[model samples]
Target chain A: MLSYLPIQLIPILPIKMNYRQAKTGKLLIDILPNKCDFCGCCVGVCPEDAIELKEAEIYIIDPRCTNCAKCIWSCPIEVIKFNKEGVLEK
Target chain B: MKEEYDIIVVGAGPAGSIAARYAAQNGAFVLVLEKDRDVGYPVRCGEAISREGLEAFIKPDKRWINAEITKFGFVAPNGKKVVINLGKVEGYMLERRIFDYELAKTASVAGAEILTRAYVNDLIKENGKVAGVKFEFRGEQKQIKCKIVIGADGVESRVGRWAGLETHIDFRDMESCFQVTASNVKCDQDALFFYFGKEVAPEGYFWVFPKGKGTANIGLGVSGGVGKKRSALSYLNNNLENFFPTANILTQVAGGVPSVVALEKMAAPGIMLVGDAARQVNPLSGGGISSGMIGASIAGRLAAQSIKNNDLNYINNYHKEWKKLRGKKHDFLDKIKDGLFNFTDEQFNNLIESMLKLPEKKRTVGRFFMIALKNKPSLLKEIAKVFVV
Candidate 1:
């Protein structure tokens, strides 16, 4: 004599974390202006779609980016600007 | 125990062994000391040599070669490919471990005594001249006296520094490199691939020297400035793994190569530095094996001749002969290496595009120089002047 009951379940809440905090301090995202020739190499090799070429220039979508650094290696121009502060001191 | 020899070679690498072989064959007592527990262990080289260069010392022995390459593929920054066919005078990918050990055997056969696990700490100087070396052998310190000391030690050689020579290298003149012997990559066994691009390698190039079917030494050398912030190893790990996902890594090595102008001097008062210690590597290709051996051969013969005649003045002939043989070529190549390192990404892309347009048969090493000097004909004019002079 068992009665059917509605399944009691708990929903896991999505954690809100900053992009810079996710990859510790090592994560760097760079956006190169006019230097990127839309080679599609970055787009093809990026594990995360943080890098996108629009109108023949590479732009890092900061909010959607995870800062994995896959884009930096894929860019043949090597012109990507690092998102981290104090990384590009001359 | 007190031991004495006519000539003492400080390393057991190619240069040292060749020097020892020549000296021993010339009826001079020679001793070759090696610091490594095993000769040719922890190999650090691109392992490729031209046939013309190899034939100068010893004939090609197939046992030590991994592959014989007859073609070359040069890829530009824009992914354009240029293929060059070399019918004869082929290059080789060597198995250095076997090759170096075999070289030591050749020296031994010529009556040279080789001692392993002997680390030379300081050179013995008598009356302000190099006499021999004091070294640690089997955890015990020992000193051996000899007439002439040959410092064939590799890069970072303290022997040269200890002897009061200026051997310090600038970071701008160093190429940081990373390489791994990978298997299961789809590369042509008969061709060597060279990739050039700021994106690929900031200051240098990526190479694929095949060993056999489905295997090759895949590597890259980047400029030191780019490498200083990150690393050459990090750049390779990021780029190469994606292209050759299935390629299994058998061996990995990271090192620096000199891209500077050749040393103005090579010998001083009973001391001669050969191989990387002397900065004999080709600044552009970073190939030192052939040049180093050639330098060692000349040095050994001259050193022995000088000892026999008791004429130290004849040593200057060795320096003159070495410069006559290859110094100009090295100077020209150094200029090219420096020019390539300073190219911006856009300029690099333009140069590559221009090079790709060249006819296949005309794609010589000389042509690359011409293309690099397109806007500035002064370099080409200077090269021509050198040729004429």
Candidate 2:
């Protein structure tokens, strides 16, 4: 029964974003909103130290993320999405 | 309201819980601090424990068992499968969250106080000896002074760091892993599978351990370091269709394992490390639950003995006794693991091809390892010196 609940309903986040869109047109790694439980494994494996957790919010500083995909690959919950441009808009 | 206690153990996983339980059971005032609000909130393991060692501590209970497996197979990059059949393999895939929670509860019932949401930030040191820990308990700062501090805080432990121990590992020795519990897998409910090859899991390996009928935990460990290419999740994602095309994800998790040992130094004057924090995993298989609990048992009993006797030197026994217990075996495993990681994909295929030549009935776990090492006589001799001695 616990698995059946939508990830958003799991309460991994109290302040949930609907979606993080890639505004830069460059390849971006985005955390699919509401699904990330903020486990911080990505922050641990990021080669560039681009990913950071500030005030319980997960963000990949635009300058450091090389689109190496480690952050997306390292995400345990699998909520990280990779994009060239606004992929979540679809 | 004395803040000082006899023993303080951090992290309520198996090692910490067992240490606390034994310390309290021996009449020492014990306290356990867990950062997570829940005892086993995010399961980071493949959850398999060999009955060979686990039974020595606690009897098997139905509540925490997911599946009991008796057979396993290793598949090489070339699809050569070597099936190992034993009269009994004695491995269990656990529901770790519940298992850890129950273990902590057992410690509490044994007289150790348990606290959740307590994030230990630093050590309370007096004259460069660890006397206690400073922690943030649910939004408030709290510090407790104790005679002994046990660090069972997983792989990235700072407690060991604060004790001035070099808890660092070569990135190559670290296995970055991603696993998922899922249903509709085509694996045998009573058997486990290991897949090897550079394309499959790089230097580590991929595994599928079934929980029950049509469900299992499928995952892989990718080689970790600065120049690491593929991620464990991507490898599993790319290969899941090859093995179980119909697999449906139930739960997914990502983690890293310190596939090494703490033979050099696992303790200081007043502090000790166990479990992943102690780097106590089997280097070859990266399994730790049972071995860690065994270390914890030694640490716990010695912590109690030393305290009860007011002999701080008894704390020294934690290292000696634990080494006497499992140090040699883990060292052997590390050597074997390093050897295996250096094997090329063709070597994996060759190893599998060689193993497959044995009669299916002769492919028991013992023989598989024996024959795998037969190719490397020097390593075999080293294994003999460590394990056989």
Best model per DockQ: 2
In model 1, the runs with Cα more than 4 Å from the true position are: A1-90, B375-378, B381-389
* Residue A23 error, candidate 1, Å: 38
Candidate 2 lDDT over A1-90, as tens digits, reads 878889887677455333342233354677765666555456545555455442235666666666766655445445777765533422
- Which candidate number has the best lDDT? 2
Clashing pairs in 1: A76-B199
All candidates' lDDT scores? 0.73, 0.78
The TM-score obtained by model 1 is 0.78
Fnat values, candidates in order: 0.00, 0.06
* Local distance difference test, candidate 1: 0.73
DockQ of each: 0.02, 0.09
Candidate 1 chain B — worst ten consecutive residues by lDDT sum?
A: B167-176
